[model samples]
Target: MNTSELDLRELLSFKPRGGAISFLGQRMYLTDLFSHGLQQMELCRTLGPEITQSIIVRAGFSKGWLVAERIKRQMPDAWAEARKGKLGPLLCSMYGFGEVLSSQRRDGIQATPLVETYFISLYEAEQHLRMHGLSNVPVCWEQIGFASGYVSNLEGRTVYFIEDECQAKGDSYCHLRGNYLEKWGAEITPYLPVYSGICNETVAAQLADVLRSDEALPRNMQDKINLSLKLTSIEDGYPVSNSYAMRSLLEMAINVAKVPTSVLITGESGVGKEKLVQYIHKNSPRSDKPLVAINCGALNETLLENELFGHVRGAFTGADCSKSGLIEAADGGTLFLDEVAELSPATQVKLLRVLQEKEVRRLGDTETNHVDVRIISATNKSLEAAVEAGEFRQDLYYRLKVIELNIPPLRERTEDILPLSRYFLMKFNQELGKNHTGFHYKTADLLLSHNWPGNVRELVNAIERAVVLSAGPQIMPEDLPHEIRDTLCLPSVAGDIRALHEVEKDYILAVLEKLDNNKTQAAEKLGMSLATLYRKLKEYGALQIAICSWLYSIAAILPGV
Candidate 1:
């Protein structure tokens, strides 16, 4: 069949029971586009870009070569059409690689025809852009290899396709030019090893061996991979811990869970006080019982009273029926009062009475009901400060803080950043149907560097947003929220204010380091002249003798000197 007559849909088939899918009578299965990107990312990360490119190119060559052979065997007429430079682009487009915008051949130029093909919306380039951002060179390695393989098989001579322009490098489109290897000469030497070296099978086997043996990887990388797996395996709805502080806090929580005394959790807002409460409740003596929770700050005085101590029928104008309060509903379980500091003085008295008497008296009801419930109060504000200010009762503060547990803010537990990020990545991946493998290295750096002013809740929102925006196998820095991506990696001088000169010296050195010690660039960025920067560095005793000598020579040549 001619290329124009081929029907792509008719050549593929699948069974409803899901045994196997067939494409052109060959067994095939669909794969997520991001899966290939993930493999590329991991291979590049572990093996370096050069080797990974070679492997991917060779694999694509093998695939294209096999497909050419299949076409020759199944339809000899189509093979003739392919030899005319008509079928390759059609096949490529039909297989969903991309749309070939144009294809042209000049047969009279040489013994072998010279072919030029321009493709838009190439999946390879899109994948590269998504995974690694813009690259410095052409990144459509597989597409080049495929074209070379297909053309070489058809012409019975070695042919090479060089991608002169690629979208991966921020080009408008990918442009491939193909000709005999001898015609390109030295231009193709760098890629010759990819085609002439060990066969694709050997490379595949070696890669498989390397991947199967954890000993082959560096120790730190192995640890990172193991940590990732461990994070992924954690059960959902449980608090994730990586920092020693958080782990120790969890141990404390578990120890305190066995006790039935009232516990107060203290932390900044969004520091996961509720999660700590859930952890305590799950591990407590009343594990099978209900865990009722309420945000006292969400309700005013009367509503808070009604919610805390259920109102009987005709208790108020809106109270048409009697309803159980959170304390009564949490009988034989735990009651979590979030933002307990927001409770009014009257509600605090009633809650203090409930704690002291172990009985809750519903509104407008004479008889009280005895309830057995553990009180777990949480407040972002300092109850001590509030009690001192007379805004809160001292007795109620002491009653709620029988055994206080304080959770450190996320910034203080920096080690938990990646673990929590991975946890949320896995969570949102499942929730959003994404296949993101992990964060890009730069993205991880940004996440670690962020102050996390909003704590874990901010991190959760960031990860969920990244998962929604990321188009690659890994999350990139651009996918992160702007505030996070823009977080400066400055040395924190939170409490101790240093002298102005010391701060200036640190900032200058930091800029120099960030620019890889390029003093000129650092000076430009620091908004100072080279001589001025040199003088500052010399004053700080930071200039090496070689730099000092160079500066002296430059000074000698200047008019001012």
Candidate 2:
């Protein structure tokens, strides 16, 4: 099985005698496999590379498991002999990967394969030649995974490969080194994503690794940790959050769901207020009934009134027939009135009556319809200001604000930027079918520095655009939108009036953001030791409240700061 002694004819002897080319009891046409591989490439391009890589590695692991079982049953002694630096290259070659030019066995526990003429490399090279810019990260994921799976199962341990040199990345050949899970701890943590699909470790462990490596120190690190716990504890379909501010709000929302009190959600547009509404309704006692939602701001006063309180025949100019309104439809459930601040003063009087009487009077109807419904309203504007300005009804506002939840904007919760970025990336990976692993260091820098005026919705759009336009693998700074990059790269001349300490703070934060908030990485990047970075972060109160609060305070006072 060793590359030096690999016998092609003998390896071919394992091929079954059948109509279609069969290898080790499995039959398939070369074209079929090749066609499937091509289809996977297309899916990767569409879905984002992260998902595609995960699927490929998982498929390779399953194949390796089957091969091990078959070989163990047919030739138990052969399995043991193959362990002496034989199985990896033999299986790799038989599966049409390439010739393993050489392999180094270490302590009979791990294997390193140096492959030439590899199929993955050849395919990538040809694709890049055709497209002129298709190449990015290593393209030989399945091959590397197959070797790791074969060895891991044979040795009864967790083993995986990291492709250090790849032809796709412009290397001449592919080089993969395998090791046990703990063997490369911390050193190969970034590459550990390759094992995510097959590793036996629980999700908590994986998440812990993310938080440890990419530290997002919030107002309190423990509070951030508590937020992570809340994130995992919530029911499905909730917008994933890592910021203490958001998570604390979610915790309150869940508690409020236990009561029948009216709730008003306030936040910036695109902050997922409707999602919060849905979460509250789904967790409430009325979850069995429909949860209706409407945007009051999108309708004229007449249309809004008709929509909320229903209309009988001939009630309005366009009324063709009688219809029940959103409130009646949500009789036993919850009605979410989004942008409730936009309700006209006249409409507000009607809403107040409905909230007070628990009955809705349909326009042109003689009798009011009694209903049991919990009201949940939301707005992106300040209802308080609206009340003071005499635009919103103070009585209705009080009725709606029985339990208020304010969702923090994205920029304020800077700790959430990376987590939300990954969440959206994964979402696009599944929805679009592109195989994107993650952002490049510089790209992360740009993401953190950009002042996101559009909040979470804007972040989602940016990630989607980047994923679609990015060539492959990691997203580089150039892959990002010009606005994001331009905003972050503002020129600073030597004559700039900023103080040295202020300049140092900005640079330190920039480095930390680029490094995904890892203090260690930030320290090294800034040519300072870990202690010094911690001391500086403590002094500036950046580490105390994460980064935004401190930075925003300075920016506000500095008049373009």
Candidate 3:
């Protein structure tokens, strides 16, 4: 029961029956740190930082209290040992919060002692760096709350911890100074309500209600839809996706990542092909190695060749020194060939040789160097069409297309539009220092209705522009670009307005077609019962056609439909 003898294995237990994990005999679950950070960012976007911080802090406080109470009941000696100030930091490190570098107690003006602790390599700060980049304010709210709760319970009085310096705000280490309530009066008054718990409970209840409301996506669907891809750039991490299409695409990409085969990603420009490539590389075995990317379309034949195949000294005019190509640099890792379809025939031949032989020969050099790398190429253009047109090498096309991942356009995945918009809104709000709550209802309608020809990139630009130009608390219609705003203002041809039922029929049919005549899924997405969808289709004189299409689709899969 001694704190020094505590082991993590003894404190943690797993029960596979219900897929439950327990820490200190209390239910616990593991989660990805990056995903946790994205959730925190989302909470901040919806509830504002103050409320989100309160919620996280209160949750941490509750956890700390539970742990303390459990230890006091199971190991009274350990509870007594905690009063000497050795147990809290040891337990914190044991629980993977961070490593405590130093801890000390100092005499204060009041009767209560002041506890000062310094921690390094905390997970919260690391997650912030990965997701939101550098923050201006301290962001260890949960750790601060946990320390306060643990210490307060030991002290048998209200104690609070103030984060004097935090790694999230670019501090070298996190410094937490704690003391009894009266000892640090006035400076801690504003945060006292959070520790008092009543106000935060109300805010958390309101948040729960909002999450469970009819306007929100179903809880199970939300879990399935909340997918993210961590990126190299701190500011540009993942596009939040709510579409089944994107989810299935990502699942395929992950499965394809297990091997070292060449992959070709095809999609419209700005559809996040590069992001998908990054996701694959990150999940691959060579994740710890470099991921070097080059745009074949950005460079001419000569430059692209030199970039991909490097050169020896004096290989060309002004070539003073030998250099390794991106392919060479990416040895034991991944080389991302963006816009691979734009590679000239000569460059394509050279790239094909590299893929086939796993070696790259420098320009003006007879010898070739071996490279162990995975090739992940992306293109907005169709390589198959290019091969048919004799604009690209057929052999190279086959080599690159060992596995293909095609991202659907934004217009085709309407379910993800609003989620992506809100994600971009949150991102730019931090970058632009704005406090826009969300899109106006009318503005949201305009966004969902637009075709988004430029795809995800266009949405990012639009949201950034709206965040900058928005004058009200929420993004209004006027804040959007002219093209997006004019969507609602466009006039019908001949000034003829269609009947509401006719328009509804057209929309329902469009949804069914988009889903490949999958009526069950279409109904779920459209928020209608299957029976009601059938009735509507019958009224529109399309029920028989829908049934035939469904049967045809089934016939293509099964031996008999």
Candidate 4:
């Protein structure tokens, strides 16, 4: 069988190499999209990951038309359907068509109403639109961004009037609120009294001028209120998380500020468990003291003890000179013991003695040294289980775990995933001198869908690799390592089996498109509450094009079916 040609035998037994070779099966442009967002495809131009980068470059080097043609052959239904719209949702929806353990409430096995159309993906809708063969970028594209301004009372109600003017043409709409309001009609009359009240052309013009006042609104907002928005200013910033878990962790750290109690941080490695420990120390009385970290797993009993406590002159063969230990080094600060579960029984005793006696003894020194050090130990495993199995000392466990700060794993705390991914992305982007702005929605969804077993550490490595291989302004899916492709994509692999909302909001929006933005109508049709529909749409991230897609989908499908 020729390597390029498909052969049954090779496809059957092929065990893709875990590093970058597993991506041998992925489509080229989709892969590059990942690489672009990841910044790895760009890195490949300088220092490439040949196995993965080569496939993406070789595949995407051609224009998209050819790629679309090939996609057409392999996935004809996708092509035929996309021909009716665009292939984007067909592709982009796959990013979230996986097993993601989100905080979204799942209502099991609801029957779909044959009378209603659901939100399909924008990419999918685009594919169906593209099937029409108008593939060139439109002469002009417009975006109507909908964002809520800071809480402000409008008219009589303390209501937030949704800003749906074009981000690029905000200024154009500065003179046209009446026109926009009239376009929406009586439905919005209660929200904006100006729209409900009768006004002449002159009066309407004055209102537009007032709303678009140069002295009042920012220059950027005034300039593009009418034109659809450009890509979000999400323009390549570090992602930061502000969720309850992080808040709880910060609160816990603050609560332990006055005491010198030992803090044992338990969580999967690379989940910022160490950082959480640092936060605790900084908030503690020992904020000014140095934080000395020792990885117990990397050292044995003797070395671990020596590292933890100082040694006297000639205590061990390598002890040529007397020196202060980590505990002494962190005299006024905190001592962070990483991988505490890996400590030996003998080391545990020494550590326990430090806690109980408030002093540590050097290996060879006859005198015991008293030091003021806050002990903060972290482990990737459960200390309780370790103590029960006699792998760890129970007394030591109890001492170190006085304040157990359990850092929730990345999977458990889903909210932090994107921000953390962007944090690593931005860091790698700058350090590597690449201009990768951000991950596309599809790739972002992929990142969110992944069950990060390796936690933040694995995400960091993936971003670093993407930065190393990135080609342009964004990181795309293909730039990810084979481990991500093979392991993390486990959720997407069971695509059709995923719940309605779990498939990401992109697809949900596409389904909503079948309904034309009517929440009440769509809800009545979907057999869910209007509130539930709105909440789910936002939660699934389907709100962006959900209403429009629903309109377009209904126009297309309702006519046909």
User: Mind giving the per-residue lDDT tens digits that candidate 1 earns over 107-187?
Assistant: 625754388999998998998888789988998888888887777677666677778899989899899988877677677
* Collision pairs in model 1: none
CA lDDT, every prediction? 0.76, 0.68, 0.75, 0.51
With candidate 4 superimposed using the best TM-score fit, by how many Å does residue 167's alpha carbon deviate from the native?
18
Q: Candidate 1: where is the Cα deviation over 4 Å?
A: 1-237, 490-527, 530-561
Measured against the true structure, the TM-scores of the candidates, in listed sequence, are 0.52, 0.49, 0.48, 0.50
lDDT top scorer: 1
Say which candidate scores most in TM-score: 1
Model 2 steric clash total: 14
Q: What value of lDDT does candidate 3 attain over all alpha carbons? A: 0.75
In angstroms, give how far residue 505 of model 2 lies from its true place: 9.8
Measured over all alpha carbons after superposition, the RMSD of each candidate to the real structure, in angstroms, is 21.3, 20.7, 22.5, 20.7
* Cα lDDT for residue 388, candidate 3: 97
Ranking by lDDT: 1, 3, 2, 4
Q: CA shift at 9, candidate 1, in angstroms?
A: 38
Stretches of candidate 2 exceeding 4 Å from the true structure: 1-235, 489-561
Better of 2 and 3 by TM-score: 2
> By lDDT, is 2 or 3 better?
3
What's the distance in Å from true for residue 15, model 1? 29
> Which residue runs of candidate 4 sit more than 4 Å off their true CA positions?
1-239, 486-561
